[model samples]
Target: MKPLTPRLHGFVDYTACGLMLAAPRLLRLSPQARRASYALAGSYLGVSLLTDYPPALRRMIPFPVHGRIELATFPALLLLASETQGRNRIYFLALAGMVAGAYALTDWKADPDA
Candidate 1:
């Protein structure tokens, strides 16, 4: 799948969080807000899948799942960067996320001939 833009991801995540906080009650969210919210959920899920754990039970299972955590953190960093605009952390997080994502995608995608 094609990747999402950093700003879009940020808006999505941000709006979703806002919606959740206002949940169980019918509320009006602007179209822009809704789009932003959906993207937010998608980004959050993607990032969390990369950076966070599946479950505590995974800890007891075999295989070095820490690799998964490290891999997932790339998306997390990107999301953080999106939120951290104009802040010092944004520079670092954005750089780290973009670099890591680029590396992972490139490394994962070998030539069909290869």
Candidate 2:
């Protein structure tokens, strides 16, 4: 995946999210950053679960909830969360969470085990 710009929100979210889940230990993240990573990872997990739900309710929840709670306000939240330090990194981290969520959902559908 290319390193997309801040303006390419969806793409950026996917790429960063994939990196966060796929390479959690590799990044030079802080304690707060770690928590952020975990939250993002959990969000991805939720996305994976949503696939099993009825198509109607699944369409109404999970990914959309993750988007609203995490991805949607992420950029602005990152700005406000300057208290956490590494604001820019956190924003990308949140985006990464969204990516991971999408990825997990994909894998869940594709996997023979799922």
Candidate 3:
């Protein structure tokens, strides 16, 4: 069963976007790290805005497809996250793992009606 419903996923998406946008300052990250964090934040926010969810603006893309894109993109995020050191690295790894695992567990292909 999908652990995260579309509504819950929407919450998570917004929360993650905020966290990504704030992490660089919160963690006192390097310039490259800050840029990466900003980029991810922007991308996440953009996707969420365009996603076909209750909170979305344009609703151009289906929510499940957005989830799939997140699933596909997180590994690349992990790779970029590897550039960090110490606790920041651990944080990134943990965040990436949590997101990937969450996406994996959710049934993105399931019928919205059922």
TM-scores for the candidates? 0.28, 0.41, 0.85
Q: What is the per-residue lDDT of model 2 for residues 1-114, given as tens digits with 9 covering 90 to 100?
A: 323222233343445556656554566666666566666665645553342233222433443343445445456445435555564466554554554554344322222211
The 10-residue segment of model 1 with minimum total lDDT is 55-64
**Candidate rank order under TM-score:** 3, 2, 1
Q: Estimate every model's Cα lDDT from 0 to 1.
A: 0.39, 0.46, 0.77
lDDT of 2 at 82: 59
Better of 2 and 3 by TM-score: 3
Residue 1, model 1, lDDT: 43
- C-alpha lDDT of candidate 1 relative to the true structure: 0.39
- Give lDDT tens digits, candidate 3, residues 1-114: 777766567778889888888877888877777787788788888998887766777888887889878887778768876777876677678768868877866667654333
What are the per-model numbers of colliding residue pairs? Answer: 5, 3, 0
TM-score of structure candidate 2: 0.41
- Return whichever of 1 and 2 wins on TM-score: 2
| Model 3: lowest-lDDT 10 consecutive positions | 105-114
